[model samples]
Target: MIYRRFGRTEQRISVFSLGSMRLVNVPPAQAQATVEAAVAAGINHIETAQAYGHAESLLGEILQTLPVPRQQLILTTKLTPQPQDQLRESLQGSLTRLRVDYLDQLAFHGINLPEHLQWVLQEGLPVLRQAQKEGWVGHIGFSTHGSLDLILEAIQTGSFDFVNLHYHFFQQRNRSALEAAAQQDMGVFIISPADKGGMLYHPPQRLQEVCQPFSPLEFAYRFLLADPRIHTLSLGITQPQELQTAWAALRDPEGGWGNVLRQVQQRLQEREQEHLGTTRCAQCYACLPCPEGIHIPEVLRLRNLALAHDMTEFGQYRYNMFGQAGHWFPGVTADCCTECGDCLPRCPEQLQIPDLLRETHQLLHRSPIRRLWE
Candidate 1:
């Protein structure tokens, strides 16, 4: 595997770190097999979080069955809420599940407010320090998707050893944050690179063309890691195949990814044009479980993806959504929306819900053939 020095640390980290968040509800065997595939492909960095729901347990089973020694791998996980009891419970539970006694890095997860950083310093620091002192956690860090201002403030404080931020094609505003972390020589991890602010999902064809010459994963990984500030790229690999693909992508030795960076940037610009001043529902899914069984967000997302990416995939997914309505996603019918006022204000964007429903209905019921060419 190709390795890069982890910030100022002597340890070499893989460019692509395996993330286990997508394995939510997956059987332990599947999770374990996924990890084994990644490890076999030379990925030594694995990242996960407590909030990922049963992921730690699934990972724990995988680690126990691994044939390699525990010290050979670098595992990173998170603890949120910062309460002593909750922190302790999370660590112990994670340790028990991973079947390991220690963690390479245990970061305080999802600190958005500046006050939350203070909470970590006051309450969470002691616990993490104790864990480190006792040999339970090797290092401490925090991941934030909050304000860039707060992130820069926390980095300047230098209270933690590592930080994870969202940086990608669509959101390049965190250069200052990366610079701040670099000033202290702390490890910086980038999250959701492909979907930062939902930019990479159904990017314009120009963007797709930029990456068509190479893997979009490569474009993202190379772009984020080119600066010495980034130490790791944690990706949520759902299946074993993705693990293998990432392995080869990161290990490409010429240290180049088909030289598509500039093209991809140009493509991202065109893809960005369509959403310049349009209003959009953030897809928070808070407007869920419609009493009338309207699958509002799913239909909207598929429609958005159709308009954003290739309609072929959207048509295919819609076909499946229709074919397996009661099976794949139970009670998510497009026809079930009753113009009810229930799911309206929950949206932070204040989109016209009834109009959106009309658009979604037409898209879903439209001929699949036309959708493919559109």
Candidate 2:
């Protein structure tokens, strides 16, 4: 397993960190086996959150029986931004549940709105600072599903040691946030790369073809790790097979995956160009602020992938998440587009904005699915 120094924290974190969200509904024995397999495969960093049902307690029970010493593991947990008075109780509860005295990192989980940031800065941060002073926490950070502007603002505060956010092959809007985190020397951990990275775990045939010699899932791993700014990709595994699949992708064989990585990337671009021509969504967010609250760039991008790469399932999965995901994926579907011509004048590509929205709605709309987080 490849390990990288997690920015200013100086902890050598495995490129593949275990995320415990998927294990919430799994049996304890299965969860323990999965965790044990990950540790055996050299994944030192394991993260869980209080919101994940029974995950902390399950991990605590497993950790005690593992042959590996506690010091060798880098354990992290998150708490929702809470009242100052509730902070101690929340932190202590997490620690007690995880069978640990101090946490490697404690993040303000899901600061996805502007108000959440305000709470973190004014109220949440002070209590975390006190926890640090008492040696209850080793480092402080936050996980966000907010906009790029909000993420940039949070990094600029210089109060965080690390950050957890989403950045993958299909969603590159947060690329600038990765750069900002690097500038601050903050540890950058990607959230849900496999499942959220265009649902590559069960990728369409066209996507598999474009990513030749590597499965779409493997390609996603290589794509993220190519950028040194990314410290780790959180793998939310419910079974040991998932971890093995990811580990196999990380292995360097003979001449290595470098040549194939470039080829696969070029093929992916070329395939999209074949169908999209020049009208492909650049994801520049220039066509934003839709009058009806549509996420134009994301919807159009999903449309591009679905039409060009046969990623219809991925499109449906995300498009259906419009109203269901709340702030985590804020926006209505293109069915809400009012065609005000407001975004038309702003677009640098000068594509017919309303027409594209209508097409997107036609191509990807589906019955809403329950958000995995919920």
Candidate 3:
């Protein structure tokens, strides 16, 4: 596996870092096997977050069993910075959960909002710097699901050591963000290059054509890594087969992408539609002022993404990370819709409000959510 310098840090992060959020959240034994396979395959970087249920704890058990030296590993973890003061405690708690003392990289988790980034810079970064001084964290970074504009804004900060953002064949809006990360000498880590499980199986034919000579996965990975600014790619691996597949795919990417494209063509049929990810919600949020305190736009965004991109887990992740926890100052759910039909006109997509709400409610509260939370 090729490794790259993670920003200015002394660590050489693997091009493929083990993501413990998805696969292992379902079963500890399966998670262990996946990590073992990655380690045996020469993967050195392992990333998880304190909020990711028991994935962190599972990795700790595996590390103790594996004979992998502590110094030989590049561990990255994150903490949500809402109650900013709790950021320190969160980092320490993640280390304790992972059975590590000092995190190789401690990134601010889930700052998809520009105001949040500003809040983090003004409030959280100082605490992060203090952690650095205290030797609790080696480097600082953030993982985002925001627009390219917010990403560019974060890159311009000149503060973060790395940038963890999303990229996929269907989603190239962040190309500029990748460029800015390179210019700033910050490590650009692509999170969910497969569109949060959307591209893993196969992508639409039109997308395939644009991403010619590449699978949705390879096209996404290569597209992001093509930028010298990018340092590593992280996947939410859950099984040993996936572990082996991603590593093998990247070994010689030039040819593998084409192979993947052919596989996509053989495996899935393509359908054409304009407003690919926006037919439902587009996340425009133009329909604010809901009498009930529900985050209609945000919920719709996840729904459209879940269906449009086939991100089977994104709807669950969004609910787990946002809904279950009242992180939005005040959060809302589908039950609040009241079938009022008031939001229809304001919706840019004019999606079927009640029907979509029913689906969103079902997806958000599904039993499988336990898979992501362990």
lDDT of 1 by residue, 1-374 (tens): 66777765456887778887877656766777778888887788888887777778778877877787888898998877656767777688889877789999888887777777889888888887888899999878889866667889888888778888877643465778988988988888888665433334444464356466555655666666666778777777667866544554555535454455566666644553464224444456677767876666656655554555444343344534443423223344466677888888777667777787677666656442211111
Q: Which ten residues in a row have the lowest lDDT in candidate 2?
A: 248-257
| Residue pairs of candidate 2 with colliding backbone atoms | none
lDDT of 2 at 228: 90
When superposed on Cα atoms, how far off is each prediction in RMSD? Answer: 8.8, 1.4, 5.8
TM-scores, all models, native as reference:
0.70, 0.97, 0.70
* Local distance difference test, each candidate: 0.68, 0.89, 0.70
State candidate 3's TM-score. 0.70
| Reference-based TM-score, model 1 | 0.70
Q: Model 3: per-residue lDDT, tens digit, 113-183?
A: 77888888899998889989999888898888665677788879898888887765444557678778877
After aligning candidate 2 to the native by TM-score, how far in Å is the CA of 78 from where it should be? 1.2
Q: How many residue pairs clash in all the candidates, one count each?
A: 2, 0, 1
Best by lDDT: 2
lDDT (10s digit) by residue, model 2, range 315-346: 99999899888888899988898878899988
Error of 3 at 106 (Å): 0.4
